[model samples]
Target: MGVGGAGCSAAFAIASSQGFQVTGCDIEKTSPYLDKRLKKFVSIGHDPAHLKNSEVIAYSPAVTSFDSDNEELVMARKRGLEVLPWDLFVAKELLKNKFVIAVAGTHGKSTVTAMVGVLLEKAGIDPTCLVGAIVVDWGCNYRVGESKYFVIEADEYSEKFLNFTPNIAAITNIEFDHPEYFRDFDHLKETFKKFADKLQEDSVLIVGSDVNLKNNNGKTNKVSGPADLNLKMVGGFNQKNAAIAAAVAQELGIEKDSIKKTLESFKGVARRFEFIGEEKGVLVFDDYAHHPTAISETLRAVREKFPDKKILVVFQPHLFTRTKVLFDDFVRSFTEAPVDKIILVDIFAAREKDEAAVSSLDLTRAIVGGKAKYIPSLEGAATYLVKEVSVGDVVITMGAGDIYRLPTRLLEKLEGKG
Candidate 1:
């Protein structure tokens, strides 16, 4: 259900491409993927009646977490119809008899997955791909190719990635995240170890140089991209992601020249330092970096790219649990970055109740120096930025939530159309 989400939307598209009659519904009325991919629209919300014609129900993780007792789910259980989470459905049904290359990590898995898919495609493998973010080259989050190869981004949240028995896998990097689910850092690491163990006996597990897995059954390859490789994307983290992709491509017998060519030309997935056109000489960009490490790396890259420009960050904390658990880290990330101004919006609180102990204002207060301000709303942040930002300033709208919408709103206001 929750097909409006990136993962579910890609699953819907992949299932449909495989000739399944797919119909979906989400709390959201529309999304880019829904508009482009979904052919059948069920209702906007969960309804038991929607399951009458369905033989199987594949739901997103959000639906399972937020609406556990949803009417559709209840109806499906009462009717004895098959029900599966999106990842399990893909792993069990779609990946059957295919050469699966699943990329799993705490970060950069989406980009790495897209890169591997593109590399395989360039080498005439014609592999099917399902990524968490929209690959700019494919114009969608998925690419359907008629081949035995299946490439996918294996998310570790809720331990959903364990369902896949991949022929090859990559771990870009690992750190403590999803504080809501994991008990502790060791627990998170152990879960990753289990995911690594899911690899077949002869399967190759390509890991970044920074990854430290205690034990893995598969043959592990520690790789890092060449320092001199020219890439269009910014950041050393991206170079690391490319290296892992190259390793995976190499395992699949793709040549070095083809892999390098594909990696250099990759336009990158949407919302990962994606450039939104400049308005009134203010260069704007959007990114989906919710975690502290991601924020630090992203801002560092932006600062390195535009050393002299006044970089303004409008950040919205994605989840209250994360903000509370990693509160100090969040403060340090912003304080350490080479940013000039910081605007903090309210926490997104996705699928979680508001933790009265924590808020964006708390984070703003924690940041050292007089650089951060709590704006409380996206609209307020946009309005403030419209007046505060000047020519040559680099503005970045960053978060995993609805913060991506602000760049367009800010640009419209800058253009005097909003």
Candidate 2:
């Protein structure tokens, strides 16, 4: 099967537990960011020969990225071997056997999933967990435990999360971000409502206080009000996410003190307001905030974290479809953001082609009341930032793409190496 981010994560979850003879392959032989744990089981390139001894085949949902007709998958099909997507396989083999806690939303699903996992683990409940992003505490995207509890990040892309059967489901928040898969905002909302309906009759569903979901069958708890836990993370959004995590922990009967202690000390997942090394008094951060809402919230959080400090943003739009569809909203998002200047880089087209005729310069020109500049490459942005950034300035590299590497170059520039 395709062993990209999600697939490699599932493989690690199984391999770390020592419960299965796991094997996997990607279209490429190596990745700079490949997990060290996966080096033994996963090979760089694909060959049907790798599937020789496989009994059951599990594939990543992003199978199309490698090859729709992946040779190993086709060989499995020809041999009549058991085949399933990783999500569906997890649903059938894992979620059905455990008390599943599924975190679903347009944003913050990854963080909330990690939050709940860390809380449960800190409370001495050795729960199994799978998250979309790497939890710095685990140094991986998954944790394997013998406990009956299973926590998973429920993705809404192509309705992928509908496959899982969750006893307790949580929605961090809902918004229109995935325009490539959804027809409209209403379609996204309806899909979420359908996901909420998938819980069993007695299952519990928790929604963020700001979101309004219609769940008829399950017990729904809306998280609101101040929590006793003090989050070390910077965003107001993190506080809200903590509230949601607290609600889930309370539902599981975990002591309030344990939840508070865990949330307060949580170091956060990678690429979510992660602080890179500061150089010459200029602070740099890396974040996975591609959506307009995420960008605005992150900028506002940064402003609050370093009051009166000039914030500089370097944003790389993730996909052409998103940039094209939300062009206006993207412009408006940066208008009121707590930043002094914005650097717009070329779009990072992940699994999509540029058919919408939209470009980064178009977005840069549309932004009003902000000092926005267009820099097509991360190197260009880093070079510009080196000369412009001064003391007491916070520079952020925000996106879901290779732009994260910009900070290293920014640091080099600050050190006078670049």
Note the Cα lDDT for every prediction shown: 0.89, 0.85
- As a whole number from 0 to 100, the lDDT of residue 373 in candidate 2 is 97
- Candidate 1, residues 133-202, lDDT tens digits: the string is 9899999899999999999999999999999888898998889999999998899989988988888778
Total backbone clashes of candidate 1, pairs 3 or more residues apart or in separate chains? 0
What range of 10 consecutive residues in model 2 has the weakest lDDT sum? 7-16
Best by lDDT: 1
TM-score, cand. 2: 0.94
Candidate 2: clashing pairs of residues: 28-44, 29-44
